[model samples]
Target chain A: MRATTIHAPGDIRLSDVPDPALSAPTDAIVKVVAGAICGSDLWPYRGAKAITSGATVGHECVGVVEEIGGEVRDFRPGDFVIVPFVHCDNTCAHCRAGVQSACVNAGHTRSGQGEYAVVTQADGSLVKTRGVPHADLVPSLLTLTDVMATGWHAAVSAGVRPGSTAVVVGDGAVGLCAVIAAARMGAEKVVVLSRHEPRQQLARAFGATHVVADRGDAAISAVEEITDGIGADAVLECVGTAEALTTARRAARPGAIVGYVGAGHGVEMPVRPMFEKNVGLVGGMAPVRRYLPDLLDLVLEGAIDPGRVFDLTLPLDKVAEGYRAMHERRAIKVLLQP
Target chain B: MRATTIHAPGDIRLSDVPDPALSAPTDAIVKVVAGAICGSDLWPYRGAKAITSGATVGHECVGVVEEIGGEVRDFRPGDFVIVPFVHCDNTCAHCRAGVQSACVNAGHTRSGQGEYAVVTQADGSLVKTRGVPHADLVPSLLTLTDVMATGWHAAVSAGVRPGSTAVVVGDGAVGLCAVIAAARMGAEKVVVLSRHEPRQQLARAFGATHVVADRGDAAISAVEEITDGIGADAVLECVGTAEALTTARRAARPGAIVGYVGAGHGVEMPVRPMFEKNVGLVGGMAPVRRYLPDLLDLVLEGAIDPGRVFDLTLPLDKVAEGYRAMHERRAIKVLLQP
Candidate 1:
């Protein structure tokens, strides 16, 4: 099987690896159909976060169950399924509480950009579609495994409600997905902060009512101006950088919530200012497994086209190019066909 | 007029000062009927927070309107009112959004421990009772101006709901009141972290179902034992120290919120651990003005008696003694009669 691996900073390769097999009764073998690069994957590619040499990379995919362990009740071979970034035993207390990402018995998927992947907690983690749908729906279905659901989690964590003025502080795929989430949640206005022209246009098409191409103080000022100098009713922090988080906090109105979904890098939580402003911070890893069911329905019904975020696509052998495209900002997201 | 002033750390004194006068058209002069020393006041008393020598202190009081500025409405001479620590024009965006503490045009009341105090935004900050009630209700009414409302704010921010297992992380007046708030909000089990015997009894009386006396890691373990290792559904971080905040977060179940109200003293926000656990942090200065009406009715109707937090009483002339009692932990709180 060909799988993506990172040898070092700025070095991504598609290496031959042993074929995946069900290691436990709770596991399932998934033949990857479509996998997408995520913003978080860039951490290792850019050396912002360390990785062991030749570590299995990527964690987003839509695939067909090639085989399943005896204990797997809900899924079987030949079924089309979405594999969340993290696999969790859905019966755990955290999972029952809709925080599946924090499930006690959790395992992470790390070889989505491969010919085949072994997923643990198969019965609890995989969400099967009605059938292996048309090829055109594959990309959107793939996003539900991570980015789209993550965006929705941000909206839910921020308490985005009808008539809310929502501010999304990032323009990555997740941020763009968050714009759709906020809009779908009935936010009266969705304000997106993006400096790039392409992402800004996509954000607008995805339901951003206003786009502020400013950074730092100017960005906050722009959000204030759009919100009657009161800041936003709900803020989505999709970029985990300190500056992005700071902007997210400053963009929230008093009593408003900032739902953060980005994996933090060199980020320090601003406690004093948040305390003084009575602003609340919520959200961490999106409970993608928890949201998978609803989001799958939305995607299948054509309610959202989150797949548009995939600006580039390639064969699994070109996984290195995919990583480069995302790391260099040449592509919003790159979809890999196995 | 006699006012309490802090000459230095541990140096509290009753000093003669010019009578408070209406400084703005929205101001109203109040003759103090009851004032209580707060945990926050002890900050300057112990010198944790810098204070100007001889600066007037105290910000919790129930009083009678002595005089009103020409523009003052909803309050008049002879009316008994609860003066929130922070005054705000309720018409502002923040105020209207129920975050009066962050009102754009906000003012702090800093002379509650005085014979008379001037309150700004009279119409918005002063919640007038039907009439001056008997002395029995004075103490509880005074709490509505600060602690009681603050406790409620913590519970509200933490999203305390029916059937929730709530953990209150402090033994102070606000924390005890938070226990009451959690119970009132219908939490099935109210867990209070208090080592003091006196406070533990009071917490139980206020509706705490469990008391964890351990500190640091042990305290967190005890809470886990109580909640079957799942942690509380809601946590009230009423003590603003770093250790207390850490305990609050550790005692919370994944997806639970930690509503903090204690004035932070050298506290650093724990962003990484919080992110990993999906634990949320929210709350700040309580919006007493916004919660005053509902809480006032509860007091007047005998539904709650938050005044019980004041374990000691002192004459106005002995303001120094009140501060000492609170500072030395001889009293959970002290009520001053002017």
Candidate 2:
């Protein structure tokens, strides 16, 4: 099957790779129906993250179960399911505590970035839909696999509630979805930091009450100004840079929770400031599996339209262009028909 | 008036400094009754944090209102009060949210280490006791000024609830107090990680259900073993270091909160493991004032005996010896009487 593979820095290609097959009794084959490029993918695509040549890419998808091992009892062939970025047994101590991203049995789950990918612990890793989803809803349902669920994780972790004011930093797909999630969760005023015109417009459509076209100190000043200098009741940090983290914390009221869901590297909390502010730094990898059930319901009921995050969609063969579009900020998130 | 002064590295002296008087309308003179050495004070003593030779030292104390500023309305002469380590206006955004340690109007609080020190923002920084605490309870009340309150901050920040299992790292006075605090807050099993025999005994006395005399990986293993490998529900990180932070997170169940109170100078979260664990890191300079009222009540009701933390007591002239005892590990905490 032809799948997205990275041959070198800035070189993503649709290469013919060996088809996936069930190697373990608990594994199942998922025929990728729809998938999306992730912000994290840009790490290696832009040469920021060292990637071995010929490595299969992608971690978000929705697909039909093509085959299942005997041990997989909950899902069967032709069943539509959401494949979360991180797979889990759903029974580990971590999973039971609603943090399946850290499941003890997570390492065994194979990545689901290609055609006919093998999913481990199929019963726990795949969330089967009640029925086949409509074609128009597939893109939105696919986000439950990672990005949309991640935004929900950010909002919930920050304790966003009705009547609360929130500020979301970053204008990527996840950040944009965070504005939607915060609004869905009932935040009265959702402020977003977006420098792009399209993102700002989408943010407003996603229920953003204010859009600050600034970054760093200026962005913080704008947020503070909007918040009457008291900062927001909740702050969502979708960007992982030090400056973004600082602004997020700076944009939060004392005792507010600043939820961050970026794959941050080499980031350190400025001890004195965060400590003195008494802010709670809560959030990491989204326990997407934990929130998949609720988020899927929201999409099915048309309560949220996360598919809008897919500003650009293309066939799986044009995966390289999809990566470039996202790299150049020409797309908030790219959807692919595999 | 005599006070402890750090002249240079390892150069602590009992220097005669001019007496403190109200310089601001919001300041009041506190007649120092008792003060204690802090783990953070060792930073400058070891030359890690340079100190000016003639600078007054110490931030913890309980004292009498020897003189009140014209604007002071909370107390009058002869009134006893608990002076928190950091002074605040108690009305700023941070202070209003119970983070007085980060108060915007906190530039005036003079350290209460000297015989007579000027307490800034007296109405907001001083927590007056209902009455003069008995002599036997003064030591316990003094801990409320910082250490004990700091421990309470750790437990509260970690969301310690009834039936929760908590692990406290570090055997310092603050850690011991955290054990007491966890138990006081109704943690079903409070575990203290300590290597010393006396400290272990103190931990148990302070209501620790178990004591693990190990550090680092071994300490985590012991904590996990005690919890049937499930890890504790909450972790109190009284020790501020990368190793301690890592162990605390490792010893916690996924989705658990780890509260830290040490003055962390240059610590950064080892991003990946922490992010993967999905743990929440909450803590900082304890909003000591926020918990002072409740802690003092517990001490007055004979519900907690924090005075036991001060194993050594000396006259003001022997302040240097007090610092020496704490630096040499001869005492968990040293109380200096003025």
Candidate 3:
């Protein structure tokens, strides 16, 4: 199978890797139909995070189940499904609490950026789609496996109530998706902090009511001005950078919640200031599995087109170019057809 | 009027100061019937936080209204009320959001450790008691003005639910009060991290089901072990130091909330670990005014006795000794009779 591998920093390539087979009754083999590069992938691609010489890259996808172990009860061979980013038993207390990302029997399968990927805990991790989605809708459906679900998690975690103002910090696919999530959650005003023209356009299309091209204090002031100096009721921190966290913190109103899905590499909170402002800092790894059902429904019903995040798509053989596009800020997200 | 003043660090003195007056149209003059020293006072008294020479201290008290400015219409002369530490106009957006501590028109009354103090935003800051609480209930009622309300805020902000495990970090008055708040909120188990015997006793008295007389990693490990290695669902951080914050962070279960009310002087969040664990950090300046109505009812109904935090009493003239006792850990809290 041709799988994407990152052999050292800035070295992404297509390599022939072993095809997966179900190793446990709780497992299934997924023939990956589509996958997407994640913001987290840039961590190693930019050498900000260290990875092994050859690590199977990517953690998002939708696929058709080629085979399933006998114990996998909810799924069967030839079922088109959404594979959540984390593998979990789902019956554990954590998973039962809707935090499957922290499931007790947690494990990870090889990256989905491959032709065939092994999926453990298949019954709990795979969400069966109504049918194989159209190829045009595949990219959008694929996002439910992670990105869209993650963005929805931010809104749900922040308690973005109807008629409230929601602010999103970041211009990436997830951030744009958050704008859509907040809107779907009935937010009256959706604000975004973006400087890039393409991201700004996507953000507006996704229901961002206000866009602040300014950074730092200017951005915060822009939000404050739009909110009548009150700040947003809910803030979504989509970027894992310190600056993004700062924007989320500063943009939140007193008693507001700042829900962040950022893999905070070096993020730190100024406790005193946040304390004084009474901003509730919440959100982490999205319980993507928990949100998948609702989000998949939204996607299928045309309530949201979060899949539009995939502005660029490439054949599995051209995975390198996909990463390069994201690296160069040319693509908001890239869907790789395997 | 005689008031407690911090001439310099470790130099508390009872000094003659001018009587408070109606500095603003929203002000009221109160003759303090009861006042309590707070853990925060130790910060300046112990030279941890700088204070200007002759700056008045204390912020917690219950008093009788002596005079009211023309604009203060809620109460006439001779109404007993709980004076929350921070004064805020109830009409601001923050106050409307139930975050009175961050009200736009915020101000502070004169320090409670005085014969008379001026109350600003009287209509919003003063919670008129059903009547003068019995002399025996005075100290407890005084706690509702700040400590108890602050503790309640921690439990409320953390979203303490029935059958959830709660952990209280810090052995101070606020921590003890948090134990009571958690119990009141129906937490299944309330744990306290404390090495002080008196505080441990008080914590248990306030409904702490378990006591772990350990600090740092050991304290976290003790909690983890108690919860079958899952950690507590809610953690109340009453101490503002780094160590306390670290313990609270490490002791929370995945997706748990750590509600902290400490005035974080030098606190920071270790974002990576907390993010990976999906812990939500919330809580701030305990919108005491918002919780006063409920807490006052609890106190009046013989439900919670948070006033037990005040273990020592001193006359107004002995203000110096009161500071010394708390600074030396000889007293948990001091009540000043003016």
Candidate number with greatest lDDT = 1
Better of 2 and 3 by DockQ: 3
Query: Which portions of model 2 show Cα errors greater than 4 Å?
Result: A107-113, B107-111
Structure candidate 3, residue pairs in collision: A140-A307
TM-score of each: 0.98, 0.96, 0.98
Candidate 2 C-alpha lDDT tens digits along B173-290: 9999999899999999999999988899999999999999988888888988988888889999998877888888899887888888877667777555667777888878887778
User: Rank order by DockQ, top first?
Assistant: 3, 1, 2
**How much DockQ does model 2 earn?**
0.63
TM-score of chain A of 3: 0.98
List where candidate 3 sits over 4 angstroms from the true fold: none
What local distance difference test score does each model get?
0.91, 0.85, 0.88
Across residues B161-239, which tens digit of lDDT does each residue of candidate 1 receive?
Answer: 9999999999999999999999999999999999999999999999999998999989988988989999999999998
Which residue runs of candidate 1 sit more than 4 Å off their true CA positions? none
Interface C-alpha root-mean-square deviation, candidates in order: 1.6, 1.8, 0.9
Number of clashing pairs, model 3?
Answer: 1
Winner of 2 and 3 under lDDT:
3
lDDT of 3 by residue, A213-248 (tens): 999999989998999999999999888888888888
DockQ for every prediction shown: 0.66, 0.63, 0.85
